[model samples]
Target chain A: MEQISPFKRLIASSLGKKYLMALTGFVLVGFVIAHMLGNIQIFLGPEAINTYASKLQNLPIAIKWGFRLFLLTAVAIHVWTAVLLTIENKQARPNNYADEKTVQASYASRTMPITGLIVLCFIIFHILHYTAQVIFDYKDLHYDLNGEHMHDVYSMMVLGFSHWWVSIFYIIAMGLLCMHLSHGISSMFQSMGWSNEKWRGVLKITAILIGAVLFIGFSSIPVAIMMGMIKPIIGH
Target chain B: MRLKLKVWRQKDQLDSGRLVDYQMDNISEDSSFLEMLDLLNESLVEKGDEPIAFDHDCREGICGMCSLTINGIPHGPEKLTTACQLHMRSFKNGETITIEPFRSKPFKITKDLIVDRSAFDKIIEAGGFISVRTGSAPDGNAIPISKSDSDYAMDAAACIGCAACVAACKNSSAMLFTSAKISQLNSLPQGKPEKDRRLLSMVSEMDRSGFGNCTNYGECHAVCPKGISVDFIANLNRDYAKASVKNLLKTIG
Candidate 1:
């Protein structure tokens, strides 16, 4: 009843938060696709992926960091709004159903919050493992390629995945990421009002395809490393 | 058929309810679920015990006045059937039935199995109508409508304002009901003029009612006596997104 701004009213409601989630989620999904494609270059050998990484790193600092900052902000908003909406949703049903049965919701849909939290943890660990290079010793792995000063991303990945525990963890994290995406993708379309009964089946199939692709593309690196298909480059 | 009933009993709105057990024998399987309840109430009255209170108007499923969560499923175990239409034969000979009121914050338990459903009325009052001058009835053929559009509109109009969707939802969301009304009106030529404003106001009003958000559980249509599809909710979400954008631009401009 109190006077409020239209924008404030827009994002303050449950429907508003869902719209926010859908928008930001679409951004994150795009980043995931691009990241997977870029990383899959490793299959061409150390030079291929390293060159791709260097090209990305060599961009203007403003452009590079600006994009990173934008992604980080998107992630923050997505997580924060999800938490608020979840709390409100919980408050809506104070008494839990004693003999509840999920008749139609998929396992992925039912476990979205849990999978989301797990994926968040994996993302933080992933950034620490690769981006910050602080989770493991990668100082010795950095070297120049072809007179161009570049980080040895291939060696770093090989070394990181060669360890059984890290490889297993990465694979597990990718699995959870796929599960998260399976539900999030179709749900994004639903929230955006881009889906209907006719296309609902198609949307779900598309979600599964995207999730599977990301899973296979990302995990292939670590799995291949563990299987000795990809090895650490001898030197610069 | 002999059955054991675990019916919820509450003194008043402030009091917490609990399920009390009662045995009923000689129940004919041909009798509807509500009729069985009526038989139980008759026996209770004979014993000078308080009878269970429930809401009912038409014994047929059309009215939707019956609101009960039978065995944790709204409208009993039968799909696309209201509690009034649910017969005793759906259960086993000695099966125990757990009957409770539709639980939601906005719908407070008024008594045993009856809860206040005026929250639905409040939602309808928000924007479920058109402002038109009173005049003689217009000919149905005055406005031409495609058969498909009319069918879609009628499908949505079949909703009986039952809160089964809310009860079946894990979060107690009312998206299905709200969307049905929005879809019904906005699809018609007569209701097209105020479509944008209607969507914005109705959705905001739904949010104001303290109902949970729809996560596409699909249970709403599964248990809907009228078989209202969750697709209407999707239709609503699409319209809402467009309306929100238009309204925001209008306000700023």
Candidate 2:
């Protein structure tokens, strides 16, 4: 028999793929929480957010790129394994029951792939809109915070979300993301075998709570901006 | 009671089956689901028509031979009951019951409502056992197993391999069954010797059997006749991970 690489052998099995999905999902969930925390600094006013954004930008290139690469790899593995599992899952049931019914699976659990795909699309659009600065150019939105020149992410967010359509789209995406997390968070624990009957109930509630918190925390910015509560910086 | 049953009728493995409706009258609510099917089969036989083909043995429900998807549920609407144990009283008098075979890529319908579940047997063959010496049984108290371990193992041992989990899963995954089998042995003292080998081999065979990956849907447990919890699956995942990593390290070091 041919000797297979351990990593290849791991990826080739159904259980192995699940482990990968769970681990990568864990990374992505952490990233989402951290990302939300950073973005919510906008609630602290313009200077606070501008300084925060500049500090992130001023990170050593190696550290910045290393984090980006790590996150990108995590997302890539998460999505790649998910697609594989979805395809296999589809093939597993070649025929459907005429009167199929869901028993105990939640709506969020059943629609994981759909929600995940939409979230992936949202991530791409978000990167292009903000990180890549290609969708709506915020390159000139510079701020002078205490005479320190920095990218005025605060005005850019306010201006970007000022568009009703953009805010609406962002809100919708955030809602779907929360829905995805509601199931994914709890599911990752199960996949990792860290969950059992004793902790299942608590884990489920925690998952929902985390999802709710993220939805509110992330969506509040767009909602506040759209409501004219968090106006753009004066003389921007 | 009178009822309408839309039972899947497949001639053979190659046949494209369909739900053929039959109106049944004079069915006793006391009869089990299998007995009701037997009544239907008797009528069909009397009419010189081919009776429905299904698998059943030990109608008391321990045999795990009965495999029918009653009204979209694997066993039936009743929780933790096998098809052979489900009484007709569970259904409404005028209800239309749609019965189908337990469907999955590995489970091929050989005929009406009878699928070939040998894939499960293959998984068991791969490693679902301990290599104990065959002789007069050892003393029951010899191992001194802990109460919690014995209870947990007993819970896993209750699985009868009915394939209801596969039928109920949206992905048609057999993780529940495989995990239960793994947990049953892996938790015991006798089975610990080959734990890693058993986990690796059984999971490999399961993957090779074309079952879908588990996404933690919990549908399997919902329909499991034995009420096997998905916790065994989590245990299986945990064990498999440890085994795989240990195997990798052995190869590298």
Clashing pairs in 2: none
For candidate 1, what is the lDDT? Answer: 0.87
- What ranges in model 1 sit over 4 Å off? none
**What are the candidates' interface root-mean-square deviations?**
1.4, 0.7
lDDT of 2 by residue, A54-154 (tens): 99999999999999999999999999999999999999999999999999899999989998899899899999999998999999988886788999899
For candidate 1, give the lDDT of residue B8: 89
Tens-digit lDDT track for model 1 on A1-236? 67776687778866788888989999999999999999899899988888999899999999999999999999999999878877777877776554466667788887777888888998998899888979897866666777887888888888888889888888888888898889899998888778888898999999989999999999999989988998777753
**Chain B, TM-score, each prediction?**
0.98, 0.98
Report the lDDT tens digits of candidate 1 across residue range B121-143.
Answer: 88888889877787999887999
